[model samples]
Target: MTGITDFTVKGADGGSVSLADYAGQVLLIVNTASKCGFTPQYAGLEALHRDYAERGFAVLAFPCNQFGAQEPGDAAEIASFCSLTYDVTFPVFARVDVNGGSADPLFDRLKADAPGVLGTKAIKWNFTKFLVDRAGHTVARHAPTTKPEDLRAEIEALL
Candidate 1:
């Protein structure tokens, strides 16, 4: 099966990151935006990372500008803002489009694996999250309104 570990994503440094590197880890993959109303969710996401990392859990962030031009910064700028503003330690990837023809293939697979409300394949907004189990199976798709902390029990179950 074409799981998340089958894809290669762009790193913040413009390098390719093999998703295989994260194999066996429970992942909360999120599309983020610095200027969005849900920006503060970064802290909650970081908390999830810090709290559950030793248990093989992680939060992988991908900044996207496709939603309202909310993330207009470059890679460096995005990295700096994430560090200075939220002190996030999780892996924050390069900017990407999460919907439409230009969407990243990883996200495309994620959306296909676990469609949103009404079986929608397109990501609706920034901070949309996909939870993946250790086997790389997409477990759930969360909307921007779902708080990170609210996922603790689900993550713990996978761990």
Candidate 2:
């Protein structure tokens, strides 16, 4: 079965990043948008990254414009917004479609592995998170409204 390590994603800086690079670390993969209602969640995500990074956890942000054109920005703009607003230090991937035919392959696998409410594979909105264990297996899927801070216990368990 395809796991996190089986996919490659592009970073906001135009460089290719393989999930294998993050292998052996618990990952909170989130679909983000700078202008969405959940935009403020970036702070909580950054906090999680800072708080658990030394213990082998990471928050991988992937900007998405699919929801409402809320993330209408280029890579530079996305990176800048994340840094200036939330002081995000974790990796931010290139803007991607989280649902539909154009969705990133990595997200495709994630949704397949951990379908959301009612067994729906489609990602409902921004800030949707997929928790991946140290072995690269997706363990849980959190809805957009699930705050990042609420995931502390799960993260700690994985760590």
Top TM-score model: 1
Local distance difference test scores for all models: 0.96, 0.94
Best by lDDT: 1
Residue 27 lDDT in candidate 1: 99
Q: Give the deviation of candidate 1 from the true structure as CA RMSD.
A: 0.5
Instruction: Give the clashing residue pairs of candidate 1, or none.
Output: none
Across 1-159, the per-residue lDDT of candidate 2 in tens digits comes to 767987889988888888898889999999999999999999999999999999999999999999989999999999999999889999999999989999999999999999998999999999999999999999999998999999999999999
Candidate 2 has its poorest 10 consecutive residues by lDDT at 1-10
Candidate 1 residue 132 Cα shift, in angstroms, is 0.3
User: Per-residue alpha-carbon lDDT of model 1 for 74-144, expressed as tens digits?
Assistant: 99999999999999999999999999999999999999999998999999999999999999999999999
Q: All candidates' TM-scores?
A: 0.99, 0.98
lDDT of 2 at 159: 95
